[model samples]
Target: MINVNQITHHFVLGKKGNKTIVPVLKNISFQVNQGEIVTIVGRSGSGKSTLLNLISGFIHPTEGEIIIQDKKVSEFNETEFADFRLQHMGFIFQNFQLIPSMTAFQNIELPLILKGMSENARRKTTADMLKKVGLEDFGEHYPSELSGGQQQRVSIARALVLEPPLILADEPTGSLDSETEQDLLQFIRELNRDLGVTFLIITHDDEVARIGDRTIALADGKIVESGVFA
Candidate 1:
Protein backbone atom coordinates (compact mmCIF):
# COMPACT_ATOMS: atom_id res chain seq x y z
CA MET A 1 0.00 0.00 0.00
CA ILE A 2 0.94 3.67 -0.43
CA ASN A 3 0.40 6.59 1.91
CA VAL A 4 0.81 10.34 1.39
CA ASN A 5 0.62 12.89 4.16
CA GLN A 6 0.40 16.65 3.77
CA ILE A 7 2.71 16.50 0.75
CA THR A 8 3.68 19.64 -1.18
CA HIS A 9 5.91 20.47 -4.14
CA HIS A 10 7.11 23.83 -5.45
CA PHE A 11 9.23 24.84 -8.38
CA VAL A 12 11.58 27.80 -8.35
CA LEU A 13 11.50 30.10 -11.38
CA GLY A 14 13.52 33.25 -11.87
CA LYS A 15 16.41 34.86 -13.65
CA LYS A 16 19.97 35.63 -12.56
CA GLY A 17 20.03 33.30 -9.55
CA ASN A 18 16.89 34.79 -8.03
CA LYS A 19 14.08 32.26 -7.82
CA THR A 20 10.46 32.54 -6.77
CA ILE A 21 8.57 29.47 -5.61
CA VAL A 22 5.66 28.39 -7.81
CA PRO A 23 3.83 25.82 -5.79
CA VAL A 24 2.76 22.73 -7.65
CA LEU A 25 1.17 20.63 -4.89
CA LYS A 26 -0.30 21.51 -1.52
CA ASN A 27 -1.15 19.31 1.40
CA ILE A 28 -2.01 16.25 -0.67
CA SER A 29 -2.85 13.29 1.52
CA PHE A 30 -4.27 9.86 0.72
CA GLN A 31 -3.63 6.14 0.98
CA VAL A 32 -4.12 3.39 -1.58
CA ASN A 33 -4.76 -0.10 -0.28
CA GLN A 34 -3.47 -3.34 -1.70
CA GLY A 35 -5.67 -4.80 -4.49
CA GLU A 36 -7.47 -1.49 -5.05
CA ILE A 37 -7.63 0.84 -8.03
CA VAL A 38 -7.38 4.53 -7.16
CA THR A 39 -7.64 7.34 -9.64
CA ILE A 40 -6.49 10.94 -9.40
CA VAL A 41 -8.57 12.88 -11.92
CA GLY A 42 -8.15 16.45 -13.13
CA ARG A 43 -7.46 18.51 -16.20
CA SER A 44 -4.07 19.61 -17.50
CA GLY A 45 -1.90 21.67 -15.11
CA SER A 46 -4.09 20.66 -12.21
CA GLY A 47 -1.18 19.02 -10.34
CA LYS A 48 -2.20 15.40 -10.95
CA SER A 49 1.05 14.58 -12.68
CA THR A 50 3.02 16.48 -10.04
CA LEU A 51 1.41 14.39 -7.33
CA LEU A 52 2.40 11.22 -9.15
CA ASN A 53 6.00 12.41 -9.32
CA LEU A 54 5.99 13.11 -5.61
CA ILE A 55 4.86 9.55 -4.88
CA SER A 56 7.46 8.08 -7.23
CA GLY A 57 10.19 10.01 -5.42
CA PHE A 58 11.38 11.43 -8.72
CA ILE A 59 10.89 14.80 -7.04
CA HIS A 60 10.95 15.32 -3.31
CA PRO A 61 8.11 17.14 -1.64
CA THR A 62 8.85 20.48 -0.08
CA GLU A 63 6.84 19.18 2.86
CA GLY A 64 5.40 15.84 4.09
CA GLU A 65 6.39 12.32 3.11
CA ILE A 66 5.30 9.28 1.09
CA ILE A 67 5.32 5.86 2.69
CA ILE A 68 5.32 2.65 0.72
CA GLN A 69 4.64 -0.45 2.80
CA ASP A 70 6.25 0.77 6.06
CA LYS A 71 9.21 2.84 4.79
CA LYS A 72 9.21 6.58 4.22
CA VAL A 73 10.47 7.24 0.73
CA SER A 74 11.95 10.59 1.70
CA GLU A 75 14.40 8.85 4.00
CA PHE A 76 15.61 6.28 1.51
CA ASN A 77 19.05 6.63 -0.02
CA GLU A 78 19.41 6.73 -3.81
CA THR A 79 20.56 3.13 -3.92
CA GLU A 80 17.74 2.03 -1.65
CA PHE A 81 15.15 3.93 -3.67
CA ALA A 82 16.41 2.39 -6.89
CA ASP A 83 16.08 -1.09 -5.46
CA PHE A 84 12.63 -0.36 -4.03
CA ARG A 85 11.39 0.95 -7.35
CA LEU A 86 12.69 -2.06 -9.22
CA GLN A 87 11.26 -4.48 -6.72
CA HIS A 88 7.89 -2.94 -5.91
CA MET A 89 6.89 -0.19 -8.37
CA GLY A 90 5.69 -0.62 -11.93
CA PHE A 91 5.27 2.59 -13.95
CA ILE A 92 3.14 2.98 -17.08
CA PHE A 93 4.13 6.42 -18.21
CA GLN A 94 1.88 8.77 -20.20
CA ASN A 95 4.35 8.37 -22.97
CA PHE A 96 5.15 4.74 -23.64
CA GLN A 97 8.87 4.92 -22.90
CA LEU A 98 9.71 1.87 -24.93
CA ILE A 99 12.97 1.61 -26.78
CA PRO A 100 12.39 1.71 -30.55
CA SER A 101 14.82 -1.06 -31.34
CA MET A 102 13.80 -3.47 -28.61
CA THR A 103 11.16 -6.09 -29.39
CA ALA A 104 8.09 -6.22 -27.16
CA PHE A 105 9.45 -9.22 -25.27
CA GLN A 106 12.87 -7.65 -24.85
CA ASN A 107 11.37 -4.45 -23.47
CA ILE A 108 9.28 -6.38 -20.96
CA GLU A 109 12.31 -8.35 -19.78
CA LEU A 110 14.57 -5.37 -19.20
CA PRO A 111 13.78 -5.08 -15.48
CA LEU A 112 14.27 -8.76 -14.76
CA ILE A 113 17.46 -8.83 -16.77
CA LEU A 114 18.78 -5.86 -14.80
CA LYS A 115 18.11 -7.80 -11.63
CA GLY A 116 20.41 -10.56 -13.01
CA MET A 117 17.69 -13.08 -13.82
CA SER A 118 19.10 -15.99 -15.84
CA GLU A 119 18.53 -15.99 -19.59
CA ASN A 120 16.19 -18.96 -19.36
CA ALA A 121 14.21 -17.40 -16.55
CA ARG A 122 14.03 -14.14 -18.44
CA ARG A 123 12.76 -15.91 -21.55
CA LYS A 124 10.14 -17.82 -19.66
CA THR A 125 8.97 -14.78 -17.72
CA THR A 126 8.82 -12.67 -20.87
CA ALA A 127 6.80 -15.25 -22.70
CA ASP A 128 4.41 -15.69 -19.83
CA MET A 129 3.91 -11.94 -19.46
CA LEU A 130 3.24 -11.45 -23.14
CA LYS A 131 0.67 -14.20 -22.95
CA LYS A 132 -0.82 -12.62 -19.85
CA VAL A 133 -1.25 -9.32 -21.66
CA GLY A 134 -2.48 -11.05 -24.82
CA LEU A 135 0.64 -9.99 -26.68
CA GLU A 136 2.09 -13.44 -27.23
CA ASP A 137 2.21 -13.15 -31.00
CA PHE A 138 3.64 -9.65 -31.02
CA GLY A 139 6.67 -10.52 -28.89
CA GLU A 140 9.01 -10.06 -31.80
CA HIS A 141 7.53 -6.75 -32.93
CA TYR A 142 9.13 -3.40 -32.11
CA PRO A 143 7.24 -0.50 -30.55
CA SER A 144 7.17 1.36 -33.87
CA GLU A 145 5.27 -1.46 -35.44
CA LEU A 146 2.58 -1.67 -32.78
CA SER A 147 -0.59 0.38 -32.59
CA GLY A 148 -1.06 2.81 -29.71
CA GLY A 149 -3.23 0.30 -27.87
CA GLN A 150 -0.90 -2.63 -28.58
CA GLN A 151 2.04 -0.60 -27.32
CA GLN A 152 0.12 0.17 -24.17
CA ARG A 153 -0.53 -3.54 -23.64
CA VAL A 154 3.19 -4.18 -24.04
CA SER A 155 3.88 -1.49 -21.43
CA ILE A 156 1.34 -3.04 -19.11
CA ALA A 157 2.99 -6.44 -19.53
CA ARG A 158 6.35 -4.92 -18.78
CA ALA A 159 4.97 -3.35 -15.65
CA LEU A 160 3.33 -6.57 -14.51
CA VAL A 161 6.20 -8.92 -15.35
CA LEU A 162 7.89 -8.12 -12.04
CA GLU A 163 4.65 -8.88 -10.21
CA PRO A 164 5.25 -5.62 -8.37
CA PRO A 165 2.91 -4.72 -5.55
CA LEU A 166 2.15 -1.20 -6.81
CA ILE A 167 1.58 0.11 -10.31
CA LEU A 168 1.57 3.79 -11.27
CA ALA A 169 -0.14 4.64 -14.54
CA ASP A 170 -0.16 8.25 -15.72
CA GLU A 171 -2.64 8.97 -18.53
CA PRO A 172 -2.09 5.42 -19.69
CA THR A 173 -4.76 5.40 -22.40
CA GLY A 174 -4.48 9.04 -23.35
CA SER A 175 -3.58 8.59 -27.00
CA LEU A 176 -5.83 5.76 -28.04
CA ASP A 177 -9.18 5.66 -29.81
CA SER A 178 -12.27 4.86 -27.74
CA GLU A 179 -12.34 1.18 -28.66
CA THR A 180 -8.70 0.69 -27.96
CA GLU A 181 -9.11 2.55 -24.74
CA GLN A 182 -11.91 0.18 -23.81
CA ASP A 183 -9.71 -2.81 -24.58
CA LEU A 184 -6.88 -1.45 -22.47
CA LEU A 185 -9.29 -0.64 -19.67
CA GLN A 186 -10.71 -4.14 -19.73
CA PHE A 187 -7.23 -5.59 -19.48
CA ILE A 188 -6.51 -3.48 -16.42
CA ARG A 189 -9.85 -4.45 -14.95
CA GLU A 190 -8.98 -8.13 -15.31
CA LEU A 191 -5.53 -7.58 -13.84
CA ASN A 192 -7.03 -5.93 -10.80
CA ARG A 193 -9.63 -8.65 -10.56
CA ASP A 194 -7.32 -11.65 -10.99
CA LEU A 195 -3.78 -10.63 -10.05
CA GLY A 196 -4.56 -8.17 -7.26
CA VAL A 197 -2.14 -5.60 -8.67
CA THR A 198 -2.71 -2.37 -6.78
CA PHE A 199 -2.92 0.64 -9.11
CA LEU A 200 -2.86 4.41 -8.74
CA ILE A 201 -3.85 5.89 -12.06
CA ILE A 202 -3.77 9.57 -13.06
CA THR A 203 -6.27 10.44 -15.72
CA HIS A 204 -8.52 13.19 -17.11
CA ASP A 205 -11.26 10.90 -18.38
CA ASP A 206 -14.34 10.32 -16.32
CA GLU A 207 -14.89 6.91 -17.89
CA VAL A 208 -11.54 5.78 -16.64
CA ALA A 209 -12.13 7.20 -13.17
CA ARG A 210 -15.52 5.50 -13.12
CA ILE A 211 -13.76 2.15 -13.02
CA GLY A 212 -11.62 3.07 -10.02
CA ASP A 213 -12.69 2.01 -6.57
CA ARG A 214 -12.23 5.59 -5.38
CA THR A 215 -11.58 8.99 -6.89
CA ILE A 216 -9.23 11.71 -5.68
CA ALA A 217 -9.96 15.01 -7.36
CA LEU A 218 -7.17 17.59 -7.56
CA ALA A 219 -7.18 21.25 -8.47
CA ASP A 220 -4.53 23.98 -8.37
CA GLY A 221 -2.15 21.78 -6.39
CA LYS A 222 -4.58 20.47 -3.77
CA ILE A 223 -7.13 17.71 -3.39
CA VAL A 224 -10.59 19.25 -3.50
CA GLU A 225 -12.65 16.11 -3.43
CA SER A 226 -12.14 12.41 -2.72
CA GLY A 227 -14.80 9.74 -2.43
CA VAL A 228 -15.66 6.15 -3.14
CA PHE A 229 -18.31 5.49 -5.76
CA ALA A 230 -21.49 3.95 -4.45
Candidate 2:
Protein backbone atom coordinates (compact mmCIF):
# COMPACT_ATOMS: atom_id res chain seq x y z
CA MET A 1 0.00 0.00 0.00
CA ILE A 2 2.97 2.27 0.64
CA ASN A 3 6.54 2.28 -0.65
CA VAL A 4 9.38 4.54 0.45
CA ASN A 5 12.60 4.17 -1.51
CA GLN A 6 16.01 5.44 -0.47
CA ILE A 7 14.51 8.63 0.93
CA THR A 8 16.85 11.12 2.55
CA HIS A 9 15.69 14.31 4.27
CA HIS A 10 17.56 17.31 5.54
CA PHE A 11 16.34 20.67 6.72
CA VAL A 12 17.94 24.04 6.20
CA LEU A 13 18.05 26.09 9.35
CA GLY A 14 18.89 29.75 10.04
CA LYS A 15 18.96 32.61 7.58
CA LYS A 16 20.33 32.25 4.06
CA GLY A 17 23.50 34.02 5.14
CA ASN A 18 24.18 31.48 7.90
CA LYS A 19 22.52 28.22 6.96
CA THR A 20 22.97 24.72 8.35
CA ILE A 21 21.61 21.50 6.95
CA VAL A 22 20.32 19.12 9.64
CA PRO A 23 19.86 15.63 8.35
CA VAL A 24 16.88 13.63 9.61
CA LEU A 25 16.45 10.47 7.57
CA LYS A 26 19.06 8.71 5.47
CA ASN A 27 18.52 6.25 2.65
CA ILE A 28 15.40 4.74 4.18
CA SER A 29 13.33 2.22 2.26
CA PHE A 30 10.30 0.15 3.23
CA GLN A 31 6.96 -1.16 2.02
CA VAL A 32 3.68 -1.56 3.92
CA ASN A 33 1.02 -3.81 2.47
CA GLN A 34 -2.70 -3.13 2.47
CA GLY A 35 -4.53 -4.12 5.66
CA GLU A 36 -1.28 -4.51 7.59
CA ILE A 37 -0.34 -2.76 10.83
CA VAL A 38 3.31 -1.71 10.94
CA THR A 39 4.79 -0.04 13.99
CA ILE A 40 7.89 2.13 13.97
CA VAL A 41 9.75 2.23 17.29
CA GLY A 42 12.45 4.76 18.03
CA ARG A 43 13.74 7.17 20.62
CA SER A 44 12.76 10.85 20.56
CA GLY A 45 15.22 11.98 17.87
CA SER A 46 15.26 8.86 15.73
CA GLY A 47 13.10 10.32 12.91
CA LYS A 48 10.10 8.02 13.32
CA SER A 49 7.64 10.89 13.05
CA THR A 50 9.65 12.40 10.20
CA LEU A 51 9.27 9.14 8.30
CA LEU A 52 5.51 9.23 8.88
CA ASN A 53 5.30 12.82 7.65
CA LEU A 54 7.19 11.86 4.52
CA ILE A 55 4.85 8.97 3.75
CA SER A 56 1.69 11.01 4.48
CA GLY A 57 2.85 13.88 2.24
CA PHE A 58 2.98 16.39 5.12
CA ILE A 59 6.59 16.86 4.10
CA HIS A 60 8.70 15.75 1.16
CA PRO A 61 11.98 13.95 1.44
CA THR A 62 15.10 15.81 0.29
CA GLU A 63 15.65 12.94 -2.19
CA GLY A 64 14.01 9.73 -3.44
CA GLU A 65 10.43 8.60 -3.75
CA ILE A 66 7.25 7.98 -1.76
CA ILE A 67 4.57 5.95 -3.47
CA ILE A 68 1.08 5.15 -2.21
CA GLN A 69 -0.64 2.37 -4.07
CA ASP A 70 0.74 3.32 -7.53
CA LYS A 71 0.93 7.12 -7.29
CA LYS A 72 4.31 8.72 -6.68
CA VAL A 73 3.47 11.27 -4.01
CA SER A 74 7.01 12.59 -3.99
CA GLU A 75 6.16 14.50 -7.13
CA PHE A 76 2.90 16.00 -5.91
CA ASN A 77 2.75 19.75 -5.47
CA GLU A 78 1.31 21.23 -2.26
CA THR A 79 -2.25 21.37 -3.55
CA GLU A 80 -2.02 17.88 -4.97
CA PHE A 81 -0.54 16.58 -1.75
CA ALA A 82 -3.32 18.16 0.29
CA ASP A 83 -5.95 16.61 -1.95
CA PHE A 84 -4.28 13.24 -1.84
CA ARG A 85 -4.03 13.31 1.96
CA LEU A 86 -7.68 14.16 2.31
CA GLN A 87 -8.62 11.34 0.00
CA HIS A 88 -6.26 8.64 1.20
CA MET A 89 -4.80 9.26 4.67
CA GLY A 90 -6.08 9.74 8.19
CA PHE A 91 -3.69 11.20 10.73
CA ILE A 92 -3.79 10.74 14.53
CA PHE A 93 -1.38 12.96 16.38
CA GLN A 94 -0.04 12.30 19.90
CA ASN A 95 -1.35 15.63 21.06
CA PHE A 96 -4.87 14.96 19.86
CA GLN A 97 -4.93 17.94 17.51
CA LEU A 98 -8.59 18.63 18.07
CA ILE A 99 -9.91 22.15 17.77
CA PRO A 100 -10.59 23.53 21.24
CA SER A 101 -13.41 25.71 19.95
CA MET A 102 -15.24 23.02 17.98
CA THR A 103 -17.52 20.44 19.48
CA ALA A 104 -16.40 16.85 19.09
CA PHE A 105 -19.03 16.16 16.46
CA GLN A 106 -18.14 19.30 14.54
CA ASN A 107 -14.49 18.42 14.56
CA ILE A 108 -15.23 15.03 13.09
CA GLU A 109 -17.68 16.49 10.61
CA LEU A 110 -15.28 19.08 9.24
CA PRO A 111 -13.55 16.70 6.82
CA LEU A 112 -16.74 15.42 5.31
CA ILE A 113 -18.00 18.98 4.99
CA LEU A 114 -14.79 19.97 3.22
CA LYS A 115 -15.33 17.05 0.85
CA GLY A 116 -18.75 18.46 -0.02
CA MET A 117 -20.77 15.65 1.45
CA SER A 118 -24.37 16.52 2.19
CA GLU A 119 -25.15 17.59 5.77
CA ASN A 120 -27.30 14.53 6.35
CA ALA A 121 -24.52 12.17 5.28
CA ARG A 122 -21.92 14.00 7.31
CA ARG A 123 -24.09 13.93 10.41
CA LYS A 124 -24.78 10.24 10.07
CA THR A 125 -21.15 9.35 9.48
CA THR A 126 -19.86 11.51 12.28
CA ALA A 127 -22.47 10.14 14.67
CA ASP A 128 -21.49 6.61 13.80
CA MET A 129 -17.82 7.37 14.37
CA LEU A 130 -18.56 8.94 17.72
CA LYS A 131 -20.37 5.78 18.73
CA LYS A 132 -17.60 3.57 17.41
CA VAL A 133 -15.08 5.43 19.54
CA GLY A 134 -17.36 5.37 22.58
CA LEU A 135 -17.99 9.09 22.49
CA GLU A 136 -21.64 9.05 21.63
CA ASP A 137 -22.73 11.15 24.61
CA PHE A 138 -19.92 13.65 24.30
CA GLY A 139 -20.62 14.96 20.84
CA GLU A 140 -21.43 18.40 22.13
CA HIS A 141 -18.35 18.60 24.33
CA TYR A 142 -15.38 20.75 23.42
CA PRO A 143 -11.83 19.45 23.58
CA SER A 144 -11.04 21.18 26.86
CA GLU A 145 -14.11 19.67 28.46
CA LEU A 146 -13.20 16.04 27.88
CA SER A 147 -10.70 13.88 29.77
CA GLY A 148 -7.45 12.93 28.07
CA GLY A 149 -8.69 9.54 26.97
CA GLN A 150 -11.93 11.01 25.73
CA GLN A 151 -10.07 13.66 23.81
CA GLN A 152 -7.88 11.00 22.21
CA ARG A 153 -10.92 9.00 21.23
CA VAL A 154 -12.32 12.15 19.65
CA SER A 155 -9.07 12.50 17.74
CA ILE A 156 -9.32 8.91 16.54
CA ALA A 157 -12.94 9.36 15.55
CA ARG A 158 -12.12 12.47 13.58
CA ALA A 159 -9.36 10.64 11.77
CA LEU A 160 -11.52 7.64 10.82
CA VAL A 161 -14.81 9.37 10.09
CA LEU A 162 -13.85 9.93 6.46
CA GLU A 163 -12.90 6.28 5.99
CA PRO A 164 -9.47 6.97 4.57
CA PRO A 165 -7.49 3.94 3.39
CA LEU A 166 -4.50 4.43 5.70
CA ILE A 167 -4.13 5.72 9.27
CA LEU A 168 -0.86 7.32 10.34
CA ALA A 169 -0.63 7.50 14.11
CA ASP A 170 2.25 9.16 15.95
CA GLU A 171 2.71 8.32 19.64
CA PRO A 172 -0.95 7.55 19.92
CA THR A 173 -0.78 6.53 23.58
CA GLY A 174 1.95 8.82 24.76
CA SER A 175 -0.15 10.76 27.25
CA LEU A 176 -2.55 8.13 28.53
CA ASP A 177 -2.51 6.02 31.68
CA SER A 178 -1.62 2.35 31.20
CA GLU A 179 -5.24 1.19 31.32
CA THR A 180 -6.33 3.88 28.91
CA GLU A 181 -3.44 3.03 26.65
CA GLN A 182 -4.48 -0.59 26.62
CA ASP A 183 -8.05 0.34 25.77
CA LEU A 184 -6.88 2.55 22.91
CA LEU A 185 -4.64 -0.18 21.55
CA GLN A 186 -7.46 -2.67 21.67
CA PHE A 187 -9.68 -0.19 19.86
CA ILE A 188 -7.00 0.29 17.22
CA ARG A 189 -6.66 -3.46 16.83
CA GLU A 190 -10.38 -3.80 16.32
CA LEU A 191 -10.30 -1.07 13.70
CA ASN A 192 -7.57 -2.92 11.85
CA ARG A 193 -9.32 -6.27 12.06
CA ASP A 194 -12.89 -5.27 11.27
CA LEU A 195 -12.43 -2.26 9.03
CA GLY A 196 -9.20 -3.45 7.38
CA VAL A 197 -7.66 -0.02 7.86
CA THR A 198 -3.93 -0.06 7.28
CA PHE A 199 -1.94 1.45 10.17
CA LEU A 200 1.58 2.85 10.30
CA ILE A 201 2.10 3.66 13.96
CA ILE A 202 5.11 5.53 15.36
CA THR A 203 5.82 4.83 19.01
CA HIS A 204 8.70 4.58 21.48
CA ASP A 205 7.12 1.73 23.46
CA ASP A 206 8.16 -1.82 22.68
CA GLU A 207 4.85 -3.07 24.05
CA VAL A 208 3.07 -0.79 21.62
CA ALA A 209 5.19 -1.99 18.72
CA ARG A 210 4.33 -5.60 19.53
CA ILE A 211 0.68 -4.91 18.75
CA GLY A 212 1.51 -4.45 15.09
CA ASP A 213 1.60 -7.12 12.42
CA ARG A 214 5.31 -6.27 12.20
CA THR A 215 7.69 -3.88 13.91
CA ILE A 216 10.45 -1.67 12.52
CA ALA A 217 12.99 -0.23 14.95
CA LEU A 218 14.75 2.99 14.04
CA ALA A 219 17.83 4.63 15.47
CA ASP A 220 19.61 7.80 14.39
CA GLY A 221 17.39 8.08 11.32
CA LYS A 222 17.76 4.53 10.00
CA ILE A 223 16.09 1.19 10.39
CA VAL A 224 18.06 -1.11 12.68
CA GLU A 225 15.67 -4.01 12.84
CA SER A 226 12.42 -4.99 11.13
CA GLY A 227 10.52 -8.24 11.55
CA VAL A 228 7.42 -9.84 12.99
CA PHE A 229 7.46 -10.32 16.75
CA ALA A 230 7.65 -13.89 18.08
Residue 136 of model 1: what lDDT? Answer: 95
lDDT of 1 at 21: 82
Q: Write the per-residue lDDT of candidate 2 for residues 1-230, one digit (tens) a residue.
A: 99999999988999979999999999999999999999999889999989998888878899999999799999999999988888888989899999999999999998898889999989999999999998999999999999999999999998898899899999999888899999999999999999999999999877789899999888999999899854
Runs in model 1 lying further than 4 Å from the true structure: none
Q: Look at candidate 2 and give me any clashing residue pairs.
A: none
Which stretch of 10 consecutive residues in model 1 shows the poorest summed lDDT? 221-230
Model 2 has a clash total of 0
- Give candidate 1's error at residue 129 in angstroms: 0.8
lDDT of 1 by residue, 1-230 (tens): 99898888898899767978899998888999999999999879999998988788787788998999988997777788889899999999777889889999999999999789999999999999999888899999999999888898888888888899899999998888899889888988988999899999999988889889999999998888999743
Point to the candidate with the largest lDDT: 2
- TM-scores of the candidates in the order shown: 0.96, 0.97
